[model samples]
Target: MKQSEIKNLSLEDLRDKLAESQKQLTDMRMAHAITPLENPLQLRAARKVVARLLTAITEREQESLVENGK
Candidate 1:
């Protein structure tokens, strides 16, 4: 997903997507271990997606903290 798309998602949706993406990444790794994937680039892409989702989550959390004067 694009950063713009990720930014559009609410925190709840982002969390859900993060969980789903992490599961998919794990499955992909297991499958690749059993047999070489047709395209290994998929793993890189999936990892980047997970990272972006995490970054977004952290940004929101920090924003909340700042707003609350924590």
Candidate 2:
């Protein structure tokens, strides 16, 4: 997913997506263990997407905290 699209997702949606992505990553790893994937780069791409989503979430939360002065 693109960073812009990910950032547009609501907090709940982002959390759900994160869970789903993690599950997919686990499945991919298991599959790879049995037999290497045709495109192992999928794992790397997925990881980067997760990281992007997380960064957006953290930044939003931090912005909220700063705005609230808490």
Candidate 3:
């Protein structure tokens, strides 16, 4: 997903997306181990997406912290 799209998501949405992506990544790995995926790049893409989602969530949390002076 694009950064713009990710940025538009709420914190709860981002967390849910991240959890779902991580589950998909795990399933992909298991499937790849049993029988090669038609496209291994799927795993890579999922990982990158997870990273992006986490980054957006973290940035938002930090912004809130700063705003609250915590």
| Best model number under TM-score | 1
Residues 1-70 of candidate 1: C-alpha lDDT, one tens digit per residue: 9999999999999999999999999999999999989999999999999999999999998999999995
Tell me the whole-model lDDT of each prediction, alpha carbons only: 0.98, 0.87, 0.94
Q: Kindly state the number of residue pairs that clash in model 1.
A: 0
Report the C-alpha displacement of residue 49, candidate 2, in angstroms: 1.0
Count backbone overlaps in model 3: 0
Show model 1 residue runs off by greater than 4 Å. Answer: none
Model 2: how far is 43 from its true place, Å?
A: 0.9
Clashes of each: 0, 0, 0
Candidate RMSDs in order = 1.0, 1.3, 1.1
TM-score of each: 0.97, 0.89, 0.94
Give the higher-lDDT candidate: 1 or 2: 1
lDDT of 2 by residue, 1-70 (tens): 8987986898778888888888888999899999999999999998887888788778878888999996
Clashing pairs in 3: none
TM-score of 2: 0.89
